[model samples]
Target chain A: MPEMYFSDAIRAALDEALTRDASVVLMGEDIGPYGGAFGITRGLHEKYGPERIIETPISENGFVGVAVGAAMTGLRPVVEIMFMDFILLAADQIINHAAKLHYIYDGQVKVPLVIRAPAGAGRGYGASHSQNLENVFLSVAGLKIVCPATPADAKGLLAAAIRDPNPVLFIEPKALYGARGEVPEGDYTVPLGVARLAREGKDLSIITYGACVPLALAAAGELSEGGLEADVLDLRTLKPMDLTALEATVAKTGRCIVLEEGPLTGGIGAEVSARIGERCFRALKAGVQRVAAQDTPIPSATPLEHAVLPSVAALLAAADRLFE
Target chain B: MPEERLLSAYRKMLLIRLMEERIGALFTEGAIAGTCHLCIGQEAVAVGVAEALELGDEVVSCHRGHGHLLAMGGEPARLLGELMGRQIGYCRGRGGSQHLSAPGIGLLGTNGITGGGIPIATGAALSAHLLRTGAAIVCFFGDGATNQGVFHESLNMAALWSLPVLYVCENNRYAMSEPVCRTVAGGDILARPRAYGISAECVDGMDVEAVEAAARRALAPLRAGKGPAFIEAATYRFCGHSKSDKLLYRTREEEAKWRERDPLTLTRLKLEKAGWKETLPWIEEEVRRQIAEAEEACRRSPLTPPETALQGVYADA
Candidate 1:
């Protein structure tokens, strides 16, 4: 294993898929020559050529729907939306067509398309560009949502997403793209609906995913200093969620705090916590708590954005409050 | 041979008209659950374009898509079963009239949203190009869909990438109750595609032969992978937009004027003048028999069990 940026890990997974399958294609705005808005797909166009690495116009609705159609026929298309907020433009294609095509057609068609969108609010991109829309897609039944916290999981999860015979929404935390971690070299796939233990503990469980994983782990380390050990769980796949792992973790610790980057109301945290209450209520030492962003648009100013989003300090405080 | 081709197109169109009428009758009888958008008068566009398609060619149809599905060799019993919400339906009763798909016959699906299928059809063309399948894609949309942003975006992308897609806009002079003239800018719908640099043709959709000829010419360049093409079929929907529509938007005189140039009547007269008078009766008898069988099949197909409702939401999840 070698330490690599999360962005590089994604690129490596895409490169492996492209090499393995001739039908695998990359389509997105500025994903070819410009490499991508975040520079993740850099040099792929040169290596894979124009046919495989398609540079699309600023048409999210057009290109996303095209990916769905391409997937329906024979090709395995991985469409990249510049930002998670931009997925709103392509919602009909993703939610209505891509998600329902296989089921509505009674399993006649397979929409093997991966929609990669960079989400989360941290870099002061304003309300429009920096909102986490994963919760918006959680209600959509057929589509799978994967948000990787570690570089290794990012590579493995993305590889699996490309190979899966269904539509997958790969949400990359924009804040974590440059974060470095050890990723395996060769073919590896992190199965969807599986959770990874970021840190082992017995006091309580810090249930989280995506960019919040590191923050939860950091908060767990701080809590350990105060003689309280917490289990930090990284839920790689959000949809078809790893409730088995959740049960195990909750049964072990008997207390939990679900963390997310999106707004508090009707967010992923609410769903996870509700499930925890329903399934693991007998084991719970305390009610399931949710530490998430305030119900307000992510702002352009750094101070205001920090106030709106959940911070590592906030998680540490929440953990301390849980013990109290 | 020419007469046979014309007759085949005519038969498909007649099947659509009859099937839509039957579905409407079923809805009135409260046998059909969901509402339907009928393609009664605008049959020529679907029949003509479907006539031009080669085997394995795909189509993405819009909300008013019964005609397109029927023209693409869709099974009457399965389609009727779908509207009746039975297990034997094309979508197994999950998707009703607004969302019908028969991939076996190369129809992707009838989309529920306006202009939603345009990009999906473009993607199918992209797939054909990438897979070297040599199959073309025909996207059927309505006049209302032209206002959607994806319509313009899909056409621009298809043209720019040389995708093998023929965008067929059934400009039936109305978008639901709203007239197209008032909704669309400049009121010249054909100019939309021409602005995208894609070759566009305005065809008389009441004349199946004219539409078929226009489709053949438009599809030639598309099948050859030269580029995308657009055909604005000037047609009219004889019925109200949907089962809920009260027909309050337009005048009876306006409707009467369009009815005089009805596609079925136009095709019947053309066939009669071409000495194919006997063909109409024979075709009508065959269609009537098929419709009867389809109705029986619909009655026989069972409803899906409540326990299995959650199945097929995700495969191998």
Candidate 2:
């Protein structure tokens, strides 16, 4: 294992899939010579040539649908939406076609497609560009949502998503793209619908995924110093959620906090907490809490954005109250 | 040989007409759980395109898709059963009229969403183009669907990438109740595909042979990997848009005029001109027998179990 940036880990997965399978292709705007908006696919165009790494003209709806079609016809296409904000344009294809085609046709087609897009707020990208839309797809039955926390899981989860039989939405936390962590060499996969414990503790459970995973770890570190240990659970795949691991952590700690970067109402936190309240009610010593963004749109100003998104300080404060 | 060709085309168009009329009856009887859009006057377009396609070549259809499915070799009994929400249906009773699909027989899918199947068809062409599979795709959409953004996007990408897809727009004069003239910008769906640089043509959708010939010509360029082609079939739907449509949008005179140019009638005339007039009675008998058998099959099929509804949400699950 060697330390690598989270962005590079994703690139590595794409590179490996393209090399290993002829059906694998990269499609997006400026992914070729431009190497993608954030330069994640920078050198891939030069390596794989223009045909395999396709460049389109800002038509997310068209290309994502093309990926769905290709998936049905034996081509494993990995489509990149430059920013998660633009994913709304392609939502029709994803939800109506890609997600339902398999079931709609009574298992006649398998849409082995992956749509990778960078999401979340850290930079001042304003309302549309900085929002996390995982909640939009959380309830879509055929769609699988995977958010990687570490460099290792970034490569592993993406590899698994690419090889998956169903449609997968690979949401990248843009804030953590440059974060450095260890990833294995060559190919590997972190199975979907499995949770990983970022840190081991007993007093309380800190449940989170994607960008919030790192923040939960930081909060747990502060809690640990104050003689309050917490279990930080990283949910790698959110759709076919790993309830087994989630309940285990909550039942072990008997207290939990659900954290997400999306808006609070009908968000990931709300869904997870409702299930936790039902199944893990007897295991709880304290009421289940949620730390998420406000129901307002993400702002452009740094301070305002900070107030909107979940923070490590907020996680700690929530943990302190769980003890009281 | 030409007489048999005319006869075969006549049979498919007649089958769609009769089958859809049966589906309408089923809808009225409460046997059909969901709404179904009939392609009564537009059979030539679907039957013709499917006739021109190779065995492995696929056809993707829009909401008015039962014709496309049947023309592409979908079993009538199974399609009827599926529409009736029976366990022994094409989608195992989950998908109904709008979602009819038989992938193994090259009927890719029928989308409920307008303009949704355009990209899927374009992508199938892309897969064929990339893999050199030589399987061209035929996407059947309505005049209304041409206004959808994906229609423009799919046509552009298909032309840009040299994908082998034949985009057939069944301009049935109206989208539910709104006429295409009012809904489409510039009132020309044909102009849209041409602007995207695709090889385009318009044919009288009432004449099965004319549509079949146009589709055959389109497929030659597509199969050669030249690029995508567009065929605007000037057809009309004889029935109302759905089970609930009251037919208030058009005058009865207009509907009667289009009915005179009905695909089945036109194809029957073609058969008569080919000196197959004596065989018409026997052909009619064969069609009636098949439709009756299909109706019986679906009626006999048991209701789909409730638990099975939860089964297909995920392929792996």
Candidate 3:
């Protein structure tokens, strides 16, 4: 085991994917010499050269569609849409073209394209740059959405996403880029659609993912101090959302809280809460409690930004309500 | 060009024209379910451009794409079956006329969304370039697509990476009701690619030989691994944009003017001048018979079962 930053883990995963498969190419703006906006692709470009490490212009729709096309023909193209907010520019390609190709073309083509985007709040990048759009893509049928919360999961999930036959939207939490964690040495992969139980408990379940994983874990730890043990599950992948695991956890613990950093409306938290209400309703527990950002644009100011986004304190409060 | 190839191209264009006209009638008769975009007048561009393509070359087409499939040697029976929602259709009846993909013939797809195929074509080109597949891509789109952001982005990528792509812009002058002049700035469709440093040319789309010559010239450099090229085929659609269009935006005089340069008639004149005096009627009769047989087969094809709609969303995912 080795301690690595989330960014380094992602870099390692990309390196492995490119080295293992000659068809795997990374395309995005400022991904080559500049090493991307967050520097996740720093030295990979030097190792892979210009063809594999393609630095595209500010053409999100163009490159994303190109990735779809390339994936269909022969190559596996991983497109880095610098920010999650910018995925809107490429939505038509992702939703209308890439997502529906398999179904519409009747499985004649497989779109093995991965669109890597940094998502989540609390970076003070304001409304445009910071926001989690995994929930938005969850509605799309054929695409897979992966939101990894830890360094180990980041490396594993990214590797799996690249190898998956269908298109996968890999949303990296920007706030967790520099967070360090113990990652396995070589050939690591966490299967998509499986929930990672960060900390298991018998009293209550705190279901969360991406940036909110740490906050829920911290809240669960704090709740333990107050004589309550909370089960913290990190939903590594959102679309193929480990519902079987979620039902099992919710059935055992009975009490559950859905935690996320995005807005409360139509968020993944809502979906989790609704599913818990539907599947685990017979298990003795209070209603599902959700802790999420207020329904508003993430402001640039530090205090305001922190106020709108979910905090450890908020998760603690929301978890306490699950027992109440 | 030899007489046989010329006659074959002319016959293909005629087939497309007849097929489109029959599809229009079928829609009116309530036989075809969904709306259709007929490329009745722009047959030459499809026939000529497709004539330049080889076996492995792929074409990404726009919504108005029956002509593209026909020009690429697509069977009319399968295409009409697609329109009629038969199981033997290219997409197995799920994708109506707008989404026609013949992977066997390398027809990538026909997108309903405007300008959606440009980047896909670029990616296909990149795939060829990376894998040394020796395959070129031809992207067929309308003039309205020139205003799209993806159009500019794809062209820039094609130029930057020197992808083996030929961007064929069928400037049919109107996107739905809005004329290219009214919508696109400066109304110079070819200038957009020329500004992107791609070798661009505006060809007489109504003339099959001119379009063929231009496409050949563009594909030469593209085949040699040089970069992407653009050809803006100045053409028109005699019918409305879609089944919903009322044709109120453009006057009858303009339509009459474009109809005079009908691609089939232009090709007929070429064949007549080449001393094939008896060829036009014979070709027309052959195309008519072929289409009728295709329609008969299409009518005989079975409709897809409604329960199998959810069958092919993912492949063992």
Winner by DockQ: 3
Error of 2 at B78 (Å): 0.6
Q: Tens digits of per-residue lDDT for model 2 on A1-324? A: 789999999999999999999999999999998889888899999999978998987789999998899899989999999889999999999999999989878898999999998999979989988989999999898999999999899999999999999999999999999999999999798899999999999999999999999899889889889998899999989999999999999989999999999999999999999989889899999998899999999999999999888988888888878988
TM-scores of chain B, in order: 0.97, 0.97, 0.98
| Candidate 3 lDDT by residue in tens digits, B1-317 | 68888898999999999999999999999999988999999999999999899989999998999999999999999999999988778987888989989889989999999999999999999999999989989999999999998999999999989999999999999988999879899878878998989999999999998999999999999999999999999999999999888899999999999999999888888889999979789878888999999999988889988988977676565
Question: DockQ of candidates 1 onward, in order?
Answer: 0.73, 0.78, 0.79
Proportion of true contacts reproduced by candidate 3 = 0.82
Residue pairs with backbone overlap in model 3: none
Model 3 lDDT, residue B160, Cα: 89
lDDT of 1 by residue, B1-317 (tens): 29889888889989999999999999999998878999999999899888888998999998888888889898899998888778888988888888889988999888998998998999999999888899989999988999999998899889888999999999988899899879999999988999999999899999999998999999887787799999999999999999999999899999999999999998898899999998799999999999999989888989867666789888663
TM-score of each: 0.98, 0.99, 0.98
Candidate 2, residue B105: the lDDT equals 90
Model 1 lDDT, residue B180, Cα: 85
For model 3, residues A19-122, the per-residue Cα lDDT tens digits are 99999999999999899999989988889999999998888888999999999998999889899999999999999999998888777788998999999878
Q: By DockQ, is 1 or 3 better?
A: 3
Q: Candidate 3: which stretches are off by over 4 Å?
A: none
